[model samples]
Target: MPTDISRLVHNVNEQGFTALEKTGLRGQQDQGLVSTLISRDLSGSDDLCVSWGRILPGQHHLCHHHPDASEFYVVISGAPLVHLGDTDYRAKPGDGIYIPRGTTHGITNDGDEDVNLVVGVSKPADWQFVADE
Candidate 1:
């Protein structure tokens, strides 16, 4: 995925950020989960991908795993109950959540406000989700 280097740099002010495709939870729609694409191969960076994501208040996403990318989520606001492997924890602002490649994980926003997160992946690859059933 090669991008034009003539205008490779990005800024939050100059152009609006791209929104991550609203792929529903496990092919189901209207799930109140939002992911906004911030960086990827189109950004001229093939090493990593980044996004801004949020779960609507009182919403929860089903468990899923990424096969090729180690995922990281930096809590930006609100408390999100994060489930990783066999354990779960309440995440707060400034907290960094790590999900190893192939680890089963999911998150929920049970609080009064939306759980906002800055999500990053080690590689710029299409996310491969394996439903934890």
Candidate 2:
């Protein structure tokens, strides 16, 4: 995917920072999940695709899985109910959650505050997204 400059602010050009506003790279998406891509394989140099994401209060997203890539979710603030494989776990702030390849995963935010999070997929360009049932 080409990098659209419209979403990028001067911070992208001034600093060596990549734009974090790109969205919609993964397919196991909850329509309500707000995602901002931090980096991706678009330039052929990115081995991972990373994003800053948010699950608003009271939102629950159905699970999805990556066929060929490992994934990770880091809780920046607010705990969300994290679903990995067939189990559910309560996540806390500053926790880095790891999901192996082909594991079904999703997240829910039932707290009063929004769940701020960071999500990453290794080998984004080579992985297949399966919207798990």
Candidate 3:
């Protein structure tokens, strides 16, 4: 029996998985920062990736960008400062921000409480492109 290349297996917990924080990036922090959840190269979806992150007060995620994919962030708790290119915006609960592909963006927790958000990418990311500047 030959498996069709176009057919994908849809299993929630059966895909190739990796934790973002465990990768040793600058954004990986112990107390004030965390990439708590992630789903990458999802079982049946090659074009989409998702991650959930929490940033505590005074913590910041290094500025970076995704050249090959667009991203959307949905704020789930608290409020955070979102930087898109050269502009900054405040995103609170239920707020969403759209970052076009190849645009620079980052987030920081300037409030007193922890900020949690869900980020979705249209395609798998190329970490090499995430710059510090």
Candidate 2 deviant stretches above 4 angstroms: 1-29, 41-44
Model 3 ranges with Cα > 4 A deviation: 1-42, 125-128
lDDT of each: 0.73, 0.70, 0.68
Candidate 3 residue pairs in backbone clash: none
lDDT per residue as tens, model 2, 1-133? 9887643422323333232222244633353454435444333336777666767787766677878899898999998999888799999998999999989987888889988777788874656766775
Mind giving the per-residue lDDT tens digits that candidate 3 earns over 55-97? Answer: 7788777677877778899999989999899999999899988
By lDDT, the better pick of 2 and 3 is: 2
- Where does candidate 2 clash, by residue pair? none
Q: In candidate 1, how many Å is residue 36 off?
A: 4.0
Where does candidate 1 stray beyond 4 Å? 1-38
Residue 113, model 3, lDDT = 93
For model 1, what is the error of residue 105's alpha carbon versus the real structure, in angstroms, after optimal superposition?
A: 0.7
RMSD of 2: 7.3
